[model samples]
Target: MTVALLETAWLVPLYPLLAALLSLAWSPGLISRTGPRPCGYLNLLMVSAAFVHSVVALTALHTNARAGAEALYRPITFGWTWLDTAGLRIGFDGLITEPALVAMTVITGLHVLVQLYSIAYLEMDWGWPRFFGSLSFFEAGLCALVLTDSLFFSYVILELLTFGTYLIVGTWYNQPLVVKGARDAFLTKRIGDLILLAGVIALLPLTGTWNFHGLQGWAADQINNHNTLPPAITLILLALIAGPMGKCAQIPLHLWLDEAMESPLPSTVLRNSVVVVGGAWVLLRLEPLIELSPLVQTVLVIVGGTSALVGSLIALAQIDVKRALSFLVSSWLGLLFVAVGLGGIDVADHLMLVYPLAMALMLMAVGAIVLTNITQDLTQLGGLWSKRPLMGLAFLTGAAGLMALPPFGGFAALRELLELTAASSSPAVLGGVVLITNALISAGLIRVFGLIWAGRPSVFTTRSPEVLWLMALPTFVLMGLMLHLPQLLVINGVFSLSPLPGWGPQALPLLLSTLVGGGLSAVFYLRPHPLAHLPAALGGLQDWLAHDMQTERFYHRTVVWLVVSLARLSAWSDDRLIDGFSGASGSAAMAGARRLSLTTSGRSQLYALTLVLGVVLMAIWLLATPAAAPELVRPFS
Candidate 1:
C-alpha cells in the first residue's frame, strides 16, 4: 500500500489543482448560495490529503531504506509522453525519491496549515475564492516542481508559480499598493524565468537531455573527462542560475519579495517559507552543471555573499515588519547560494530543509500579532509579550530555530555550512563572509523580536489580545516541529548527534556571532535604550537602508528607466521611421498614379484623334528631314 502511494504520487498535485479550478465557479456565483467558504474548505481538504499522502510515501520510502530494500529506496521514475514529434519529444515525467517526498510533505503541509489559519485571518474577506484558489494553485505547482524530473518541466512549473504569485499577491486588487506589488513581482520574476527558459532550451541541444539524472551524468562525464567547456555552455549554465537568483530573491532581483508582502499574511506565510525556496530547489539540482565552470561558481559566490550581507543589513533598517522579514528571507537563501557555489550541496540541502519551517513559524507568530493589533510597522508596535505570552514564546522558538542557537535545526545547518566554507579556497575571507552574514541575520531576528514584544506599549500594542485559536494552533504546532527538527536530523543522519547539543568545531564561533549580534540588538531595542544612535548620526544611512538601500530608486534610474526609454523609442520608431516610410511611399505612388490618370482625358474619341494627329506629325517630320527620310528625299532630288 505504501509503495502504491509512491506510484500514485503525481495525483497529489491534481487534488489541489482540481480544487483551484472548481473555485472559479464560486467567483461566477455558480455556488453563491453556499458562499466562498466552500472553496476554501475544499482546498483545505485537498491540501490536507496531499500532506497525508506525502507523509505516507515518505514513511514508506524510509521504511524500505531501513529494511535494506535497495529497489524500493531507489528513485522510481514515471512519466507519460507529453509531446512527441519528429525529433522532438517532451514528457510529463516524475521521480519519486526520498527528498522529493520530503519536499512534497513540507509544501503540502505548509499549505494545509496556511489554509486553516487563513480561515480566521481573512474571515471577512470577499475575495476568498481567489485567495484560496491561488493558494491551492501554488501548492500544486510546488508539489509538481519537486516531483518532476525534467529541467524543461521545472521551468514550466516555475512560470506557473510566477503567475500564481501575481494572482495571490493581488488578492486585494482594490488596493493600489497591492496592484503595484503584483505587477512588479510578476515582471521582475519574468525576467529570470525568460532567461532560464533560454538556458533550458539551449541545454537540451548541448547535453542532449532535460532529465535531472541525465544532466548529472552528462556534467560529471564532461568534468571527469577533463573536457573544457565551451564559453557558450558556461554562459548557459550561468543563465540557469538566473531563475533561482530571482526566485530566491537574491541581489538585484531581490525587491520583489519585499513588495509581495502586499498580499495577505496567510499567503505571506507560504511565500516566505516554501515559495521563496522554490528557486533554491532548482539551483541545488543545477549544482553539478554549475560545478563545471570556475567563473560561474565565482559569480555565485559573489552574488550570494553580497546578497547575504546586504539583505540582512536592509532587514535591520526596515520599519515595516513584513518587509524586514522578507529581506531576511533573501539573506538566508543567500547562504544556500553560497553553499551551492562552494560545491557544498549537502550543506545547502540542510539549510533548505530547516529554513521553511523556521520562517513559516516566525511569519505565523507575527501574522497573529499583525492580525490582532492591526499594524505591520515596528514603530507602531511594542510590549506584546505580556498580552500574548504563548505567541511570544512561539516567536522565540521561531527565532531560535532561525538563528545559530544551540540544539535548534539552524545551528546544525550553519555548522555544516561553516565547515564547508572554511575548507574552501580562501578560507579566511570566505569563512568570514559566512560568519558576518550569520551575525547580521541573528541581529536582525532579535531586533524584530525586541521591537514587537520587548519594549513599552505603543498605541497599537496597548489593546492587543491573543489571536484566534486557529492562528495560535498552527504557530504552536510549527514551534513543536522546529524543536523536533534537530532530533529528526539526527534520526535521518543528515547530522550526527553532537557531543554537546549543537556543539562542534565550528559551533563556538557561530554561537558567539549569534550572541554578539543578538545581544547588541537586545540592548538597543529590548533594554529601554537611551543608548540608541542619534537620528542625525544615522540620518542618511538609516533612510537608505530603510528604503531598501534605495534599490528601487537605483532601478528606476537604471534598469527601469532603460526599459521605459527603449519602449518609448520603439513606439516612436514605429510612428516615425516605419510608419513614415510606408506613408511617404504610399503618397508618392498615389501622386504618380493621379498625374497619369489626369493625363488621360476620359474621352475615347479625343484620345483616338490625338493618336492619329501624333502619327501624322511624325510622318511630316520624316518627309521634311533628308536624314530621316533618305529614300523619300532621293526622288525629290
Candidate 2:
C-alpha cells in the first residue's frame, strides 16, 4: 500500500494545477454571476486535497522506515521521458520518499494556510480569480519542484515560479509601483534562469545525466577515481551557483525580493517562506557537485556570509515594516548558504525545516496589523497590544521562534549550526558571524515589536481592532506550529534533548549575542521613546543601509547602465546603419522613378517626338565622332 502511494506521488502537484485551471471559470466574464469569492474557496479545496495526499505519503514513508522496511524507504522514482534526441535524454523523474515528501508537506501545508489567510485578507478585493489562480499555480510549481529529481526540470520549475511571481506581484496592474516591482522581479530572476540554463547545458555532457541521484553517483565516482573537475568546468559550477544565489536573493541578485514587497501580503508570505528558498533546495541537491570545487565552495561561503551580515544590518535601518522582514529572510537564507558551503547539509536542512513557520507567522502578524491600521510604517504604529492581544502574542511567538532563545525551533537549529561551525578551522570567526547575525536579527525583531506593540498609542494603532477570523485563525494556527516545532523535533529524534543542557562553549556566543541584541532593543525602544532614529553623525551610513546599502543605485551605475547603454547602442545602430542604408536606397529608387515618370507622357506623339529627337542626336554624334562610331559598330559586327 505504501509502495502504491509513493508510485502515484506525481498526482500531488497536478492536483493544485488542476485547481488553477478550474479557477479560470471564475474569471470576470466567464462566470460573472457567481462572483470571485467562490474561486478562492475552489483553490482552497484543491490545496487541501494536495495537503491530504502529502500527509498520507509522508506518514506511509515514516511507517515503512519504522517497520524496518528499508527497501521500501528507498526513493521511488518513475517517470516518462520528456525529451530524447542526439543521445541526450531528459525526463520528469520523481523521488517519492522522505526529504522530498517532507518538503512537499511543508509547502502544501503553507499553501493551505496562505489560501485561508488571503480569503479574509483580500475580502474586499475584486481580483479573486487572478489572485487565487496564481496561488494555486505557485503551489503546484513548488510542489513539483520538490518532488522532481531532475536538475534540468528544477530550472524549468524555477522559471515557472519566476513568471508566477510576476503575475502575482502585478495583480494590481493599475499601481505603477506594483508594475515596476513585477517587472524587476521577472527580469532579475530571468538573469539567474539564463545563467542556470547555461550551467545545465554544460553540466549534462560532463555528468552524462540530469537526474539528481545519477549526478550524485557520478560525482562520487569521479572523486573516488581521483579525477577532479578542470578549471573551465569549475567556472561552470560557479555559474550554476549564481542561479541559486539569485533565486535565494543573495547579494547582487538580492534586490528583487525587496521590490517584490509591493506585492500583496499573502503572496509575500509564501515568497518569504518557501518560494525564495526554492533556489536553496536546488542547491542542496547539487551540494555534492558544488563541493567538488573549493573555489566554488569559498564563493558560496563569501556570498552567504556577506549577505547574512549585511542583510541583518540593513534590516535594522529599514523603516518600512515589510522591508524589515524581507531583509531578515535574506539574512537567514544567507546562514543556510554558509552551512551548505561549510559542508553542513544536515544543519542547512534543519534551518530550512524550522524557517517557514516562524517567518510565516511573523509576516501574517504584520499583515494583520497593516490591514487594521492601513499602514506599515513602524514609526506610525504603537500601543496595539491591549486591543489586539492575539496579534501581539503571535508576533512575540514568531519572534521567539526566529531568535536563538531557549526551547524555540530557531534555537536548536542555530545551536546545531553553531556546533557545526565550531568544528571548522576558523571557528571563532565563522561562529562569530552566526552569533552576530542572530543578535542583529533579535534586535531588529524586538525593535519592530516595541515600535508596533509597546509605546503609547499612536494615531495608527489608537482604535485598531483584531483582524477578521479568516486571517486570525491562520495566524494562530501557524503560531501554534511554530511554538510546537521544538517539541515535535524532540519527539521525532531530530533534536535529541532539551536545548538548555546542550549549552556549552560553542553555544555561549550565540546566547550572548541574542541577549545583547534583545537587551539593547528593549532598552532603547521598548518604552514611549522617540521612534528610534540613527544619530546625526551616522546620517549618511544609516541612509545607505536603509536604502539596501544603495545596492540598487550601485547596480544602476554599473549593471543597469551597461545593459541600458548596450540596448541604446543596438537601437542606434539599427536606426543609423540598417535603417539609413534602407532609407538611402529607397530615396534613390524613388528619385529614378520620378525622373523616368517625367519622360513618360500620356500621349503617343510625345513618345514618338522623344524617340525621333534621340535618333537625330545619335546621328549627329556619329557624324562628329567616327572613332566612337567604330567602337559602336564593332559590337554590332
Candidate 3:
C-alpha cells in the first residue's frame, strides 16, 4: 500500500467511534421505529470494517518490516494540535500504522466475535441498541488508547473508557447491584485517572512535551547527559501508576471489577480481555520514564509482587466464579508489573501479548456458563460438564492457559517471570512467593471449575437451560487459540527459552514450582475426596476474597466519603456563608439608611439650618486666619 493508503489505518478506530456516535445520536424512537437488529447490524458492519482495516495495516507493517523499512514503524500523526499552553505542547499524535495496527486488530477482532456472541446471549433483552452501542464505543476508546502517543491523550481516552464501563455495567439499570457496581467502577477508575492527569500535567512542564516518543527521547537524553530530574518526577511516576493500578485492578483498586461482574457477560469479556490491558500498555509505553527513578521501580515491584501474592490467595477463597477470575486477572497483572519494574520489557511485552488471549478465553467460557445457568456464583450450580461438553472443555483449556501449563501462552510468560525472579536479589524468597501464588491460582481455577461442572446437579443447575452455539462457538474459538498460542509466540520470538543470565536462569525451582502447583490443584479440586472440607474450610476469607478485600468500602469511606463531605461543606459555604454574608451586608445598609431617614424627619428646615451654621463657621475661620484672606487681597491688588 502507498503511504497515504497505509495511513488509512487511523480510520480503523475512527470508523467505530463514528458509528458509536451515530448510534448514540440516533433517537430511541427512531431505533424503535426501525428495529434494534438494524442498529446491531450497522454496528457489526462498522466493527468489521475496522477489523479489516487493522488486518490490512498489519499486513503492510509486516511487509514493510521485511523490506527493512524502519520508517513504517513510526507513528502516523494526524489532525490539529490537541492542546498547547505556556512553554508546553501536545498534539493528536498516534501510531496509526505499526505495532498499534496489530493491537487494534486483536482488540477489534475479539470485540467483533464477542458482539456476535452477545446476539444470542442477550437475545431476550430489550437493551440491544444500548449494549451494542456501548460495545462499539468501548472498542473505539480502546483502539484510540492503543494508537495514541501522548500521555495527556492517553489519560483522556482512559477516562472516556471509564465512562463507557459505567454505561456498559449499568446496562441493566433495574438491578440495584448493577447500578452500584457501575458507579463504583466509574468512581474508582476516575480516582486513578485524576492521579494520572496530575502526572501528565507535571510531566509537560518537566519535559515540555507529552508525546510518548518525545518524552522517551527526552528522558534518555537527560540520562545520557548526566542530568538529574527533580523529586517531582517520582511523584509523577506514582501518580501515573495510580491509573494503571486502577485499570489493571491491582490491590486497593480491584473491588470495582468484582462488583462489575453483575454487568452482562459481554462487558465482562471486554473488561477482562482487553480493557484492563490498557493500563499495562501505558505502563510499558512509559517504561523508560519509570526506569529513570529507582524509587519508582521499587514501588512498582513491591506493589506488583504484593498484589500478585494477595490477589491469588484471595482468588483461592472466592465462591463467585467471575469474582475468582477477576482476582486472577489482578494477580496476573501484578506479575506483569513485577516484570516491568525489574526492567524486563521483553518479558512484560510477552506477558501483555499472551494475557489478552488467556483472558478472552476465560471470559468466553465464563460467559457461556453464566448464560446457561443464569448465575455466576459457583456455590449455586454444578454438573454442567455432561450437559455442555463443549463449554466444559473450553473452560478446562482456558484454565490450563491460566495455570501456565505447557503449550499455552501463560506458560511462556510465567516462565520468563520465574526466571527473572530467580536471578534477582531475593531469589529464594521471591521465587517461593511466586511459586506459592501460582499454586493458589491453580487451586482457585480448579475449584471454580469443579464447583461449576463436576458434582451432582444443584437447584440452580436443574433450572438452567442449555447454552446455545453462539456462545459455545466463541468459547471454542478462544480455546483453540489458547492451544495454539505457544507456537504463535515461538514464531514471534516470545517463546525462545534462551539461557541468558540477565534473562535469568531456569533451574529446578522454576520447573518444580509449575509441576507442583499444577499437580496439587489437579489433586485437590479436579479429583476431590468424598470427605473433603476444602470448600467449607475457607469461609469468611472466601467472603472477603469474593468482595475483593473490601477495597470499595475503604475507598468509599476514605476517598469517596471525604470528597463528598468536602463538596457538601463547599456547597454550604457558598449558599450559607458567602451569599449569606452578602445578603446580611445589604440588609444592614438598608437598616442604617432607614435610621438616618428617621433622624432627618421634616428634613428641609434642618438641612437649611445646618448649611447656614456651616457657612458661618467657615466665615469666622477665614476672618481669624491671615492666610485665609490672601485670595481676597490678591484680587484687590
Q: Each candidate: what lDDT? A: 0.88, 0.88, 0.79
List where candidate 3 sits over 4 angstroms from the true fold: 1-5, 25-27, 64-68, 71-79, 84-88, 497-508, 527-540, 564-580, 596-637
Best by TM-score: 1
lDDT score, candidate 3, position 436: 75
RMSD of each: 4.8, 4.7, 4.2
lDDT of 1 by residue, 1-637 (tens): 8878866777889989998998999977888888888888998998899999989877777775542253255567789988999888899788877788889999998888899899999988888999999999999999999989899999999999999999999998989999999999999898888889999999998999999989999999997899877789988988899999999999988988988999999999999999999899999999988988888999999999999999998998888989999999998999999999999998899899989999999999999999989899998888888898888788889889889988888988898889888889988988888889888988898888988999899999999876778887877888899888888887878777757444677888999999998888888989668654447876789888889888889989999899999999999999999999999999999999999888887899989999999999999999998874556445654
- Please provide TM-scores, in order, for all candidate models, with all chains considered together: 0.94, 0.92, 0.90
Tell me the tens digit of each residue's lDDT in model 2 across 35-144.
Answer: 89888898999999999888887777767654225325455666889878988777888877677788899999999999999999999999999999999999999999
The candidate, 1 or 2, that scores higher on TM-score is 1
The deviation in Å at residue 461 for candidate 1 is 1.4
Error of 2 at 579 (Å): 1.4
**For each candidate, how many residue pairs have backbone atoms clashing (under 3 Å)?**
0, 0, 0
Q: What's model 1's overall lDDT?
A: 0.88
